[model samples]
Structure formats: structure tokens, C-alpha cells
Target: MTPRRVTVVGAGVIGLSVAHELARAGDRVTVVADRTAADSVSAVAAAVWFPYRAGASPSMPRWLARSLIRFAELAEDPGTGVDLREGTVVERAPGADRSWTAAVPAAREALPAELPPGALSGVRATVPVITGSQYLPWLAARCAALGVGFSPRTVPAVDELAGSADLVVVAAGLRSGELLDDDSLFPVRGQVVRVANPGITDWLTDDEHPEGLTYVVARRADVVCGGVAEVGSWELAVDPAVEASILARTAALVPALAGQPVLSRAVGLRPGRESIRLEHVPGDAVPVIACYGHGGAGVTLSWGCAEAVADLAGAGLAGAG
Candidate 1:
């Protein structure tokens, strides 16, 4: 098929991945965002692919599975920077409702006698951990090689993009409201702290964290410790109190990380909705499709979503013809 001119809003990992998929579909692609690809939330994330951590809602598990498989395929590309990793998600202990890992227990494994008294209570399933610092820019380069154009601009209004492209996709994440009137969408603020890990390379338990402690693996630099899931909180400034709490909790979870050099702290606002939105923006001109409000599963769901968008758009175009 001859390439169709297409414009994508937001150059974060999600937008970049969508552009890459579209370009491969032979569509001329343009990506626009407020910051460079490296400065987006995707870059800050541990970049692992675990969609179920957010729960199985919105068919997210299946979507994540598709994205993970697609990511693996892309990783096979000689130059693509995506990395596929095998990891574990330990359920140190189960709760009354078993809200944590009930949906995904790898199976009951005998707690290692070597495991400190609290090393872990039970075993949950394991999944992969992805590092996005390398992955996001790699996707950007992939899109470029496939004839996708990059734009360093923000769309302050839907009309700005809706009027300019043959087709547009809103992937602005939490900032989508600037151009999209999605009342159901808002920010779920998350804060992560990176610590230097000299020899630590495996997934370590984040301890008995009840509310916020989770493990994140980053790129060449080090691992990430977090974090808080502040709902509707969009403050980007690092909260000193929250930062201290995260560090303390992470150390407790993985004592090996105790006393490690502290690298930096980051804050991000995940786009969240009643349901992860993946439908056409009804009133936007030029047949706009939405793929935002992924909450924390944005990276995990990327490829699956790109495939869906490309498929739906391709189908829509064919139906119109």
C-alpha cells in the first residue's frame, strides 16, 4: 500500500512506538511532543512490561502479552535497542483479600532457608522487566529510519493537530486534556528513586511493602526504587518526604541496596482513565484515534496498542473505500 501522511501527537514511548508501527505500515509518520524523547515519562520508567500489576482490567493483560511479544520481535532487530528480560515478581506475603499476586502466582515455592525471616512469605508469578531509557530512543530511531518525521512541539489545542494531518493520534498521556476534552482522564503521580547497584543485577523483592514499594530495572546506569501511586496528583516537584520514605522502604525490601549511592529522584504523571482509552476521539477532525490514559502500563502496552491502532485505522480506511 502507498504510504498515507499521518501525524502523531506526543513523542513519548507510546507515541513513538505507534509512529514506528505506522511507518512500517507504509504511512508517512510525523511525531510531535513537548520535550525530546528522552525527557518523557517512558524514559523515567523502569520500562519493564508488566501490565497486570495494574490489574487485569480493560483487557490490559492480553494487551500487555501482545506488546511483550512484539517487543521481543523488535529486540531481535540488530539495531533496535529494545531488551527482553526474564524476571520474577515475588509475593512476599499474601493479604486478606489476596489483592497483590492472587492473579499471578508462579506457584508455591519453598521459601529459601537462606531467605531472611521476612525475605518472602509466599511466591507469586514472575514476569519480565524492561529498561526504557534505551528502548524509547531506539524506537525513535526506528521510526526515523522508516521515514517517520519528528517534531519538537506541543499541541495546545486539538484543532492544532486535527487540522494539520491526514490522520492524528492523541498520546499526550496526562497532558492530553490540553487538546483532548477527556474528563475521565487525569494524572496518577508516581515517584521513583534510582540507586547505584554495583553488582546487583537480578530482580530483588521490594520487601513487605503494602502500599507503594515496587521494583523497577533501568538501563546501563542502575536500578530504580519506588514509589508512590498518588492518584490525581500532578505535582512534578519531588516531595522530600516522599523521596525519603521511598528510599527507606526500598532499603528495607532489599537490604543489599542499603547504603548504595543515591543517584536521583524522578516524578511522573501517568495518564489514567475509567478504562484505558483506545477509541476514536469522536469530534476530532481527520479521523483521530486515542491511545492514552494507560496509567502505569503505558510502556507495557505499547506494541499491542500500536498494532490495534494501525489495524483499526487500516480497517476504517478500507471500509471507507
Candidate 2:
């Protein structure tokens, strides 16, 4: 098979995963982005593998299943910063959807004793918890080893790369809609506080909390506690009030967080849309594939989406030939 020159626009987990897969499939890939992986929204992710904020779609199940298998495989390599940790999702309501359990291994209903106060039900499972500080760089290094190239430029439109490459992939996160001329995309702002790890390894998420979306993810170096999901919010400024609330909620959930030293604070605007955009656009100067709008599940759905993107690009290249 002849190598196609594919230009991917985005450097976040989604784009990097797509680039890695395409390069592995013998495509000559170049990634263009305004922000490096270290500065992208993906870097701010607590990055647990559970699906969050991804709207209902039939395809979501398959994407999640594929990603679960891939992340589990990656966990075998310690250098990848992916670890399978036992965790629980507490639900204040009894009818919360447990459909996500289908993709999770060893998933089971938590016992009454396992449920936190005021929680009606819970699910315990082992899922991949990624430390983005370590994992993002690992992903980029893997891409580089696969011969994928990188360009630190912001593409205003997909047509801008038409003359340079045979194909283009739009995985530009929140800015993806700008180039695609789709106005349905918006931001779901999230804020997280990183604190010194007190040797706690278990992870917990209480999205149904009356206060806000709260979670505690203990990674190798630091414990990530957060957060708030403000839909349609574009603000990136860190609110001291939000940080204080996060600390209070997290410490209540896991007492070990009490008095933990502050490591850092971060804010990320999750690319929120009605559903994930993973389709080929026909009316472009070059064949363009759109793959963004993952919301908070970008890391959770990345591998599956990337594999699908590579297959789509391959089919397009074959059709062109």
C-alpha cells in the first residue's frame, strides 16, 4: 500500500492517538496544533477511563469497549502511565444508568457498606486511571517513534492543508467546529485541584452529588480532586471559591485528602456537543475526516475513535485509488 500524506489538526489525546494509529498503518502523518499535549485540555484530565458527559449514542458502546481493551493492554507497560485501579461510582439515585458496566471488567454493584453516606447505590470496578502529566508525553513519544511528524501551527480551515496533503483529519477539540463551520459545538468548563498524594490508591467519582461533579483520582505523583461541569461556559479563570469547595468535598469523600499539600490547579474547556463527530466530510478541497467533540470522555474513548478514524481514512484512500 502506498503511504498517504495525512495532516491531522489537533495535538490532544484524540489527535495523537489517531496519528499514532495512521502512522502504524503506513500513512505518512503530520500533526498540526496550536497547543502542545502539555498545554491541551487533555492535560487537565483526571483521565479515568469511565465514560463521562458523552451523550447517548449506539456507537458509544463499541467505542468504549474497544478503548477499554486497549487501555488494559497499555497498562501492562508501566512507562505508559496507565494503571488499572479499583474504584467506585456513587449514585444518589437508584435508577442511574449502569449500562456503562457492559464495557467494564469485573464490574459489580457495591455492597451497602461500600456506599458512601446519602448514596442510594454504587458500582465498583477496575478502570484505567491515567496521569496525564506522564501519559501525554508517553503517547507523544510513542507517536514520534512511529515516525509521525509534528507541526506547531494553528489551522484556521481544513482547506488550508488541501494542497499539502492527500487527506486531513480535524480533531481540534473545542476549535473543531470553527473549521467545520458547525455552530453546535460548545464548551463544558471543568476545574480540578491537584494535591499531594497521601498514599491513597483508590479512585472515586460522585457525579450525582448535589453540589457538583466531584471526583478523587490518586495517580502516581499527586491526587487529582475535582470538579465542576459548567455547560456553555468558556471561562478558564480559576475561581478560589471553586477550589475551596472541591477540597472540602474531596476531603469529605476521602479523609486522606485533608491537609494534603497543594500541587497545582487546572481548568479545561471540554468540547461538548450533542454527540461525538466521527465522519468523513465530502465537500472539502481534500478528503477531510472529522473526529472531535468528545467532551470529558476524550481519554476514555480515544483508542476506539482513533481506530475508527484510521479505518475511515484507509477506506477513503482506497476509494481515491
Quote each prediction's TM-score. 0.86, 0.98
Clash pairs for candidate 2: none
Question: Local error of candidate 2 at 41, Å?
Answer: 0.2
Hey, what RMSD does candidate 2 come out at? 0.9
What ranges in model 1 sit over 4 Å off? Answer: 52-58, 74-82, 92-126, 204-208, 216-219
Clashing pairs in 1: 48-130, 92-121, 106-124, 106-125
